[model samples]
Target chain A: EAAVTQSPRNKVTVTGGNVTLSCRQTNSHNYMYWYRQDTGHGLRLIHYSYGAGNLQIGDVPDGYKATRTTQEDFFLLLELASPSQTSLYFCASSDWGVFYEQYFGPGTRLTVL
Target chain B: GQQVQQSPASLVLQEGENAELQCNFSSTATRLQWFYQHPGGRLVSLFYNPSGTKHTGRLTSTTVTNERRGSLHISSSQTTDSGTYFCAIGSAQGTGSKLSFGKGAKLTVSP
Candidate 1:
């Protein structure tokens, strides 16, 4: 089975605080994505990386930043956290070949106060 | 903007019953996928049907590319099947890997 894991499964930060959510995948997939899930909104992509050192802006990337330091690791950064950023964040990884079946992490529940 | 819409926002079923979920997209999609999200848990890919029909276990997914729509059928539902089902559409343009997900259809299977 594909393995994707995220760190700080739950976090609480104040407004303007710095927050970083970590994700690592062992499936050797080239594509990694970060998404936020809110009530009635399903899942909204915030950022994605095709490979190490690559980053692509997603549909909702205004208040978030992401980095891909290695093939196995991806990070989502919130430099100035706000209450509105409070949501459940998920990290997923998939390969290019085939249908690009994505495997997701357990997700991080972030609360910005 | 490309949009994916799912019908019957919510569904309730009993054990041994069947369930059908629908998904429609506004634009042409290069890929269509079905995902299951457990309450307070992660999202798991159930099917990656870009076109035609595919089945795994008791789950069957049919995607008609020409119509830009897809359907997922669950046979003999179980309580463990209760969760949110999401359909995502991917375009050929740009990265071709980015997916636009629908609001999802929440399913509740009772014993």
Candidate 2:
């Protein structure tokens, strides 16, 4: 099983506040993804990376920027957080692109007031 | 954009009963996956059946790429199985790892 971890399991920030969510995987997976889950929206991809320093835009990329500093680390930055950004964010990693199963973190619940 | 649709927005089943969930995709899915989400919010991969059929324990998943449809069957449901089931299809638009997810089927099992 792949071990994926996230920081600050829960977060609260005011509108316009800057927030960053971190994710790390120990399986040396080459693919990493960030997603947000809303009641009716399910899980929407925000960004993804296949390697360190590489980034790919997903279906829902607006207001979100991501960086893969290392093969084991990925970060999502919200420079100007809004109440709409409040969601349960999940980070996942896979050894291969779409061929393999992706392991997910416990999730981070962000609340923007 | 790829679209994944899951049916039975919500389901209720008693212990020992059988349950079935469906997933239909808008385009050809080279990678289809089923996930079970714990009430606490962790996602556990249940199956990765892009084609054909795969089974593990009390769960079975069947996917027909040509039809762009898939189904998940669970037997002997338990209270612990109460949560949400999500069906996600990988999109080839980008790195091929990007997935389009359906809203999910909320299942509640009672003892």
Candidate 3:
């Protein structure tokens, strides 16, 4: 089984504070993604990386940045957290071949005040 | 924006019964997947049927590429089956990697 792990399952930050959510995958997948889940809406992709040192913009890339330091670690960075950024963040990874069934991390809930 | 609409935002089922969830895509897709999210906040992979029909345990997923739709069927529902089921579709973008997810169907199975 593949495993994608996320850190700081829960976080509380003040407005204008910088926040970073980390994700690590043991599956050695080539693709990693960051998404935010809000109430009444489906998951919105924030950013994704095809490999180390590579990042691509997603549908909802504003107010967020991501870094894929290695195949095992992908980090989501919020330069200046705002109340609007408060949402449940999920990190997922998958092979380029089987993109449909991407393995997801447990998710990190960030609360921006 | 690509949209994947899922029917019946919520559902209630009794044990030993059956349930079905539908997903309709605005456009064609070559990849489809179904995921189960337990109340504890962990997502478990269910199926990755890009096209045609596939079954696992008491769950069956059928994706019709021509019709641009997908359906997930759960048979003999159990308490453990209570959770949100999400249907995701991958378009031609990025050579397959990013997926658009549905609003999900919240299912509650009772004894």
Candidate 4:
């Protein structure tokens, strides 16, 4: 079965801290994405990668940076975490063109206090 | 601009009853995906149909791409089916392939 795994299921960080969220996909999909979900707002894309070494900005990418280290791994970095960045973050993978169903990870709930 | 909007915000259903959720998009989408986020917070992909109709088990998804709308229907819903249903899609592929999502429809089932 295709699976997307995210690390540190939950975390609490102080303001001005640096936080990094990691994700790995066994699906070997060409596309990987990071999104944050908050109350009243649906999941919004932060950054996405087409493959290793490629990154694309989304609607909201102000305080986030992402790196695609390998086909199986993607990372989201918060250089200076803030209270507003506290939310549930999900990592998803999909192969474009012929594939459309996106596989999402369990998600990481980060609280920046 | 708001790209996608889901209807009912939330719904409560009785076991064995049917449920319908709506997703409307503002931009032209190349494709659309329907996801079921279980109460526990794990996401399960339900459908990936850009247009027309498709079904799996007790769920049916129909997307009128031309009209920029999609509908998901659940038949004989069960208590385990309770969760938030999300609709996400992209305007196109490549650099601008990021999916814009709807707020989601939260469903609660009572036995």
Candidate 5:
């Protein structure tokens, strides 16, 4: 099993607050992704990166920005967060992109008041 | 965008019973995977089946690529099997691929 860890397992902030969720994968996978899970929306992709300094827009990329500074690190930034953005955020990594199996982190629960 | 639909939406089963979950996709998918999320918010990949049948422990996954459909079967369900199961379909896009997930089938196995 690949090792994927996430920091700040839980977060709470007021409207228009800044929040950053961090993910690190020690498996050296080339692809990393950020997704949000909501009640009726299931899990929607926010952003993804194939390697360092490379980013790709996903199905749901609005209101979110992502940076892959290094192959092992990927970050999701929620600037001026809104109450609708409150959801469980997950980060995942895969060796062969979305065609292969992905290892997921424990997930970060974010609440925007 | 590819659309994935899961059947039943939710299921309730007793311990020792068998469970079946279905997934259907609107477009052709080159790969399919099943994931299980624990109540504690941890997600685990259960199977990466593109076609045919694969089994691990009491869980089995069967996928038909041509039909764009997949099925997961759980034998002798246990209380620990209670969680949300997601089915994702992968489609090729240029040099890479993209995955689309269904709303998921919430299963509750009671003692």
Candidate 6:
């Protein structure tokens, strides 16, 4: 199975604070994604990358930025955090050809005060 | 924009019973997947059935692409089976990495 891990499993910050959520996948999957889970929104994609230095905008890209420094690492950046941006974030990875099945990380719970 | 809708927002079942979950999409989807997430845990892929039927363990997933709908059947439910089930759909024209997910169906099994 693909192993995806996220750092700082839990985060707390005040408004205007900058936070960075890191993700790394050992499966070497070409596609990596960042999603936020909310009470009624389920999971909404924020950004995704197909390979190193490749970035793709997702459904909800506002107030967020993402970087894929390497094939195995993807990061989500919150330059100015807000309460609305506080949610459970998940990082997932999947092979290039097989995009339907994605392996997810444990998730990062971000709380903005 | 694409949308996925799951029916029976919440369900309660006794152990050993059978449970059925439904998913409906607003647009044509090239890929459909079922995922299970325990409370406060990560989401795990249960089935990747875009069309036809696929079975694994006691779980069965059937997707009718033409109908833009899918169903997941869980037989012999257990207390451990209690969790939220999500249905996600991917477009055929895009990078295939983007998936639109449903609000999910919360299932609780009791002994």
lDDT of each: 0.91, 0.93, 0.89, 0.88, 0.92, 0.91
Deviation in Å, model 2, residue A4 alpha carbon: 0.8
**lDDT (0-100) at residue A71 of candidate 2?**
100
**Candidate 1, position B4, lDDT:** 92
- What is candidate 6's lDDT per residue for A1-113, written digit by digit as tens? 88999999999999999999999999879999999999988999999989999999988999999999999999999999999998999999988734457788999999999
Instruction: In model 5, state the lDDT of residue A103.
Output: 81
lDDT of 6 by residue, B33-104 (tens): 999998876788998887999999999999999999999999999999999999999774355458889999
Clashing pairs in 2: none
For each candidate in turn, the interface RMSD (Å) is 2.3, 1.3, 2.1, 2.3, 1.4, 2.1
User: Each candidate: how many clashes?
Assistant: 0, 0, 0, 0, 0, 0
lDDT for B17 in candidate 4 is 94
> lDDT score of model 1?
0.91
A1-113, model 2: which lDDT tens digit per residue? 89999998999999999999999999999999999999998999999999999999988999999999999999999999999999999999997777877788999999999
Give the chain B TM-score for each candidate. 0.95, 0.96, 0.95, 0.94, 0.97, 0.94
Model 5 is docked with a DockQ of 0.74
- The RMSD (Cα, Å) of candidate 4 is 1.7
What are the TM-scores, per candidate, against the unseen true structure? 0.95, 0.97, 0.95, 0.94, 0.97, 0.95
What are the per-residue Cα lDDT tens digits for candidate 4 across B32-97? Answer: 899998877778889888899999999999999989999999999899989999998766655546
- Give the candidate number with the greatest lDDT: 2
For model 3, the TM-score of its B chain against the native B chain is 0.95
Q: Model 5, range B1-111, lDDT digits (tens) per residue? A: 899999879999999999999999999888899999898878899999999999999999999988889999999999999999999988877666677899999999999
Residue lDDT tens for model 3, B1-111: 568999889999899999999999988776898989888767787998888899999999999989989999999999999999999887656644578899999999999
Count of backbone collisions within predicted model 6: 0
What ranges in model 6 sit over 4 Å off? Answer: A97-100, B93-96
> What is model 4's DockQ versus the real complex?
0.60
Which window of 10 residues has the lowest lDDT sum in candidate 2 chain A? A95-104
lDDT of 6 at A3: 94
